[model samples]
Target: MGADRVGSGRGRVGRTGAYAVCGAVLLAGCASMPDSGDLRGVESTARQDTQVRVFAMPPHENASPSEIVQGFLEALTSDDTNYETARKYLTTAAGHTWRPELSTTVLEDAPETNAEPVGSREEGEEFVFSMSGSKVATVDAQQSYVPVTGAYSRPVHLTKNHEDGQWRIDALPQGVVMGKSDFQRNYMSVNKYFFASDAEAGQSPQPAAVADPVYVRRRVEPMTQMVRSVLKGPTKWLGPVVRSSFPTGTALQAEGDALAPDDQNKLTVPLNARAARVGQGRCEEMAAQVLFTLQNLTPAVDEVELRSGGKQLCSLTEGSHADAVAALTSAQEPDYLYFVDGDHRLVRLSAGSGDTKAEPAPGALGEGEKALRTVAVSRDEHTAAGVRLDGKALYVGALVSGGSLGDPVLRSEGKTEENRLTAPSWDVRGDLWVADRDPANPRLLLLEKGAGEPVEVETSGLDGRVRAVRVAADGVRIALVVEKDSRRSLLIGRIERGGKTDGRPTVTVRELRSATPELEEVTAMSWAGDSRLVVVGREEGGVQQMRYVQSDGSAPEEQAPTALPGVEEIAACQDDQTPLVANSEDGIVRLPAGAQWRKVTEGTAPVYPG
Candidate 1:
């Protein structure tokens, strides 16, 4: 620990600079040093305040078992491409057996090491070390980040190497472990775009790109790794609901160097020959997919040029080919925001004009044929569905000037109002979704084209009764507010569909995971963007608040939306320019970006087209 002594391994200048800084920080306090000296340039590897790279230092001669464990932990946080230096401290067998790619366990801070006293009769054993910490979250092999809460403790056994007489880890976990701050510095989350199946694999007149987010190393040729991750297809959790535009077996042309955007801010992607066979239209879509994925990393990328086998296939310009890959949520581009007026009639405010005046929808439902409780507009804005104010029935009608309302499309068998039908939601495919709260036969129903016979969609792995439902614009995911024991939790589920069974298509909601597990109650929620949602909920013993959460149960980069008190229902879309409308104590309120909420009208259940 002498100031003159510097550690060496890999000869990294940053490691040396780090030691110098540590020495300065210490000597500046305890020991008296020259306060003023001739300013001189020193060898430093850090180019900026934030871009400091930490390099791993190998084990010192005859280090203790505790020191070995601590050094290994630090190595996990270093920016080693292949982790070859980190593995140097381990015995050949232990190094060969370790697998750092399986998963990542993030803790609140560096794990503390404690060694048990060696009083055993065994002649050769050195020590048994325990590494423990407060758990924060875990990243799975699929690279999905899931926040967790618990205590983590693990044992590490070390024995003297027969050949080198050095203590090495003989038993340890397979994956890497690091602190949250280190994890943030080492990894980043990015969304890879894919086309939605729309409940059918190959049957759709149109298309929209859905986001599947995954985490990857930040400083280690991330663009190259991301290209491969996209070609590998969606993660297991999201795979069933979405389909990638890239063909199977498609991969980046192998190159040993890092892939980076060029001087003109354009990226040239070389793909395998599989991509060369695609038609012009399909190839452009492929370029769009890559462009979308890289946008999360390098927003300034102006274009993405795709090539295969030394042949130019196609190119996608950010401004010109942006529509080549449409965001599932904002595909239709909502023109009006819908809500129920004080008179219990469906009304809308034109989004383009930023109009505050409310006008009755052209349909009969808007003409007061039936007092409305809640409403959902189709993604196309061509149709509307409404639940009865009494919550007994659901009906669909057009939003045109002469549109007529029809008989109830679905009915709830619930005996009381609280046990009746929930508000309706429309997917991008124009299907209507609602939950029947009948205690005897509680069910989730879907109507094709908003007017077909209602079918009970399966809710697999569900633990509570669904209180409300909102379908994503991709039409393959659904968000539910499930109630159990007087508490409501928000869960995101994948919608799975099968071939027709007795002339009816079979549908199921699978793998319902909590989008807001930290919250004790979720009162209202809506699809705010592709793979993002605006949620109104609260933690245990905490007051209610509104925030944006990823569909995969991760926190979004954007902070909580403007907080409005008494929010009963909240609505948002992928378009940030569009104001967020909500039903609050001030009646119907609209919040433009960076502005306070203004009363739009006296209404409830303000919603944009999903």
Candidate 2:
């Protein structure tokens, strides 16, 4: 919607040609007026007529008064060239006064006004007609062509004409003038090309058909520019920068808990308590890698050398101790090493390209000279939990500030019943749950902050001895593997806050089946989700099977029997996304979500390689 004007005349028109021609025509019809009496009657009738017309009209169905105004303005500025449809609503005099020759096309639409109505008054109205265009006019005889465009509009005053059949409208107000220029003419051409082309009709243009490569490059240029902008920040670049700086192959290590298989040869060993190890192993051991140390007995020196795929990767003594720990603990891309020191301090190490190292012993345990027994790192590695030899459990411990062994941030005592302490499993919320060994009155001890004594959760109806205990992610649900009368079962029950069991903490059990149609002994159980559990068991034939049980009774499912390989021990990683299994004679293997089993690390002695 635009217009333009060009010079037409070279000299200014005389007064007669400029104003008299239009004025005479307008005033000619007004020369004769009706009688005063007739005028008053006409005015009264016209007032009633106007009122009736206004009342009969429906309420403004459009959005708002401002919207109506904007719509009218848009119609006026349209490129349709004919504005009669938009001008029909204005008074005759207003239309005549519009200077189309002086006005230019609208460059941009202005924001609508927020002003609301405050009533209206009108003056006398008059009819007018005029036409004007650009002219090169000389006021002082020197001729110069001056471009111009003009429009006309009529204004009507309603309030002042209440008593008479008369209305007044001056020429269109100066404030209503819209500007015009050559730039607007150029924009008009662009607008026409954009709106009137076959490309706008969804047909590919000829240029696009001829140069596919250039078209693709142009299409992708904007996205590439945006990516460059996003990567220009320090924090934004930090990730890739660190990755590039450290690169890969940097050796690092940390000490953490490693799960080992229970030795049936040791009669005093707890059935569920597997051997724990503390020593250094390579960070890349895909199998269960555990390190153990006997009092004054050095591990086989040959074992210290790093090996991969039966080939030596590097000598252990070649790297600094700190660097070795850093590399071993770094699990970036799934490389991890579990270490055990001579003092029985356990550490888990992941070696990536970076210099980050985790010292599970002192870093998480805080200022402690105590030996660490069992340690577990969550799937995210942000959380590490360990049990001290003092029969106490420590958790939420972080690595030392400088990547060295430091004290743990939080410490709590293990569950103790009748002067005997039992190791506890750390829940997602940092709470610890341990099973009491009392056969007649077994219970689960819950240790949370401010609770002096462990909250006893009765396990009477579980139908067996509680062999292993685990808490759900919510910390309110407990899962126990019960060996009931030679049959194995999984018991799930909620923990009551006040220790009252008025049907709130109801317990449910599901039997695990062996290949021979008999209930198999449950070896381990881990939560897969809010309502699912992954259970591992050994059939009579010694074949290992993993079963997924839905707590909500949705469906019972099981994975195909998988040979335990050389591994005699198995435990589910706390993460439901990946199931963690340990081999007594090999190493740890991670069964990733929806993927085949892969080795994570190799186990150390006293720590079965399984």
Candidate 3:
């Protein structure tokens, strides 16, 4: 729920203020909170980004009810793996029932305590204190993060121990609540890898890995926690399109085991018999999953070797090109970027090179046989798809010079230009996707290998007309620009293929959900990473701006891209090393890594090989 300001500036993006870990609560003094008001108007008490570990102090003997409550809240922000210290502030019975790992509620700032009315607690009666803040988001037990809005109010009951005469909290919520800064300090986002369901069915040339991100405590044996998450599988939202390599019911051979890379940089994982039952090939795939999942997490894990019941299963080493798993899931970078020049002819420039000159693409489309409006290049860069300047015809041609565009692959019967076919997109499966905006007969169509009859995909729950389409590299997730009424929004939907029993699998774009809800209209978008997208759009009454949003709707403030003006079309490659291209006020511009946008040429409809 934190807004990432592009160019937020220097060391520690959005941190300021004093944080005392001695005892005041919130690292120290965070909820140095007001005691009377019932408003979540406090400023963000973001702590500095320091690696020093801070442990929660135990409750002092004979402490007042307020002191006990404040101390307990502070302990929630500490590095107690099991939260044992925080429990000291709770009554014996309450401690036994409290489940701190159930979930985490992140607020805009530290939570404040509002004292109960005077005389509300009698001599032996329990004390009640109110806690509230502006809710930002929540991390479920599975570690999936979802952005939230509005107030977060809850009550904690404090009781005097009859035996010791000291106050302790007797009732509260199941999980801990903390400010956004503390949440960022204590946890980190990590992607767990899985294979596309279609690829697992042997429908694609190679298995493509899709990323599912989850948050985990940064200092709490993260390696082991990550392994456990892998075994548990993907979150419910992504379960339909991806499959885990680990077998069902598979788990560590022993409970409470810690996973660490050895001095030799090899991580040995012990799995249960359920996992060891898999064949050699499947076992290697399992190791491949771990290798990719942890690649960004640490440098220690240079290799992964799987073992179960004291018997070795398989091993996967980083940079091992011959490894079946690595070869199947790794993504190749785009060789060139394509766009329509002033003459409506498709041209290309070497990817990531701002100094390169734009030249006509090899095929007939590049031969300038006919004018073009928008285009998509296949992942292999061997073929290209283009929508005609008139927007009525779609053509497919090879990237080779001298190639001829024989016939229009598809055409729209829409009466107006606005109802013509949208720009085309390619998936890793070698299939082409596009949408016909005809008011009377709108449709989302996919062409097998950019040829043959267009298959109208089934969209059961969609409440709008498709204005644009971009299929993810995994081919399981599809990003669509849908227009409902006068507003256009970006929605991510699952691509489920069925009826494979008859050889022709039917496709459906289901479970459509907003990826950029805060933006009232989304003009263009592209997959910028495995789980994130670079989008161009604006909020209600807001000016056009560019930002990054995760597939799950979380916009991390730290990675905000620099701004550009009047961008109509944007393009990006999965390789972060490549520069971002866009059609802006200065015409086609290039944003090289760590550099400002510079004019590339006068062009439009820029795109990278999908």
Candidate 4:
């Protein structure tokens, strides 16, 4: 969120009304308080080039206490190295103790500073001032950030220095707070990838890289900071599901690691002796983790060399076999959009051919007695999992011409039919995820392809009903629609997979967080991209609407497409560029690239291969 609009001439970025403490009485001993309103000369930087970094302007000679306070607050938004210039308005002791890196509270708009007199300003005495703003998010000391709703207030104490008659702040908050615009201008959003704990393992392994997005200082050794953040492990929210290839307590060398890439795009990472002690296999995994993490930089590092004690331990290139981790796990554009037709047959529309014709998928599944209520295709587009029309049984079968549907792979034990199985989603690993909402035995199950018993995954702290489930292509995160106390929440939880316990896959969920708190009800949702979800829901007493929200619960202000009439279900791939498919009451509709929704066929549930 940015500044609120004030008038038609000034544009949307307006001055924030704030409260502040003024300087000593200019005429007498009585200091005057500045009005929160009518404070002028604070212009918007909207017309300025956003790409250029804005540095804090230095305080002029012989500035008053109020002027010094206002200038200091404005300087907090600039790209001052170590905030050295910003500290010019603070006393020597306060400047040394004030740490701008402790936290960053992003505000909704430009904050106003009101200079109110605290008490009788006896000459050469201490003065106090306070500042506040409506916050959007707060990034903590550990760099764990979360979207929040509330106000942020803090007080600063200033005193006259004995060396000169100048006033300087002696005490203040530990960190700096800035507006969203400045945060965007000074900080860059970057993602560091880590391997899923149970990523695919075989002769030719393909481990999925889960992205953890964080904001780092834009120009101040960003590449170095990115590497340091990776060493710090995943963010708080994603730490539970993902694991670092580096051993516990592993980190970049403390004294000399600056992480600058050489001219040929090769980055030599200096690790402690601990990393060099690992075996070759473990070393390669660590290299893969570093390669994927550092590649997100603008001047991408193409190769990584790990060294310890001045000796090379391992080296990796972008083409290394262990580096086959897919960046964004979206489906390769397929030729068809498959669903169940009105005749209870598995049918597909020729989406790739730009044709509106519907045809049967293949042999038994297309023309058999087992009618599918909902279906999900694997990333390879060869296998599919379907739930029966009665929602009691699930079948896994091939999608080719002569493939036959298998017997019930999973059966619901719900006491009532309405509490049966939901749509099944297939990850790139070929594992199927579905929820059995039998109130008595409600559980989320993961079925590995070609496996017998579906492994029941436990969801700790999820008290209500699990209505719908969608697994991301990475296979490490799952989206859930949970209903509790008549309130529905769209939550994203990390998939904790315990590798092959007793020759069987074991899984659980942790770090559940709501993605869309503004919506009162989440009717349907699908993964639109790696870190975003296209959600369809309604506010209290509002009509059904469609909006895209980040999995981290930070709602962007993008305008959403209007809801389709009588829409029942929606499906999308992890690529935001891909078209969206939805099932309306009359028929299935397709939102092709840059086009409006058009009727595809008469169907109920539409899905793309994960």
- Computed on alpha carbons, the lDDT of every model, listed in order, comes to 0.74, 0.31, 0.78, 0.70
Worst 10 residues of 1 by lDDT: 20-29
Candidate 4 structure quality by residue, lDDT tens digits, 107-196: 877555555445555254577666677788877765655778898777777777777778788988998877777666556555566777
Number of residue pairs clashing in candidate 3, backbone atoms closer than 3 angstroms, sequence gap of 3 or more or interchain: 2
116: Cα error in model 2, Å: 89
Comparing 2 with 4 on lDDT, the higher-scoring candidate is 4
Model 2 spans > 4 angstroms off: 1-344, 349-368, 376-385, 388-423, 438-442, 450-452, 499-518, 540-542, 552-561, 566-579, 592-596, 604-610
Clashing pairs in 1: none
Per-model TM values vs. the true structure: 0.86, 0.34, 0.89, 0.81
By lDDT, the better pick of 2 and 3 is 3
Write one digit per residue (lDDT tens) for candidate 1, span 1-610: 0011111211110001111111111001111111122211111122222244456677778766656666676677666777776687677888999988889998877665566535551245566666678888888887777778899888767777877778777778888887777776667667777878654311344466777878887666667877888888888988987777778899888756556778887898888877878988888778777876776555446688988999898888765356634443443357899999988999988975568899998888789899999999887787888889989989899888777787898888788998999888888777889999998888999998887788989999999899999988777889999999988999999889888988998999999988887888998998776667888988989998998887777675465777788999998875555677889999988887677888887999888885
For model 2, how does the per-residue alpha-carbon lDDT over 1-610 read when each residue is reduced to its tens digit?
A: 1000010211100000000111100001111222111211000011111111111111123222222233333333222223443343333565576543333322212211222222431122223222122221101101001122233232222111235333322333322222122122111100000011111111112110000000001111212211121112111111111111111332122112211222321101011111122123322121111110100011111122323333333322212332223221111122333444335554544432222243443363333445655454433234344556553444345444333334442343325432223334554334456665555555655554312345555554455566666654434346776666676666665443432354333322223212112227666555543334556665566666665554322222234325455544445422222234444344555454455666654432111000
Model 1, position 292, has a per-residue lDDT of 68
Model number with the top TM-score: 3
lDDT of the structure predicted as candidate 1: 0.74
- Give residue 224's error in model 3 in angstroms: 1.8
Model 2: residue 551 alpha-carbon error in angstroms: 2.7
The residue ranges of model 1 lying beyond 4 angstroms of the native Cα positions read 1-52, 117-125, 147-151, 161-165, 198-204, 274-276, 320-322, 325-328
Cα displacement (Å) at residue 226, model 3: 1.2
Ranking, TM-score, top scorer first:
3, 1, 4, 2
- CA RMSD for every model? 9.5, 34.1, 4.8, 8.2
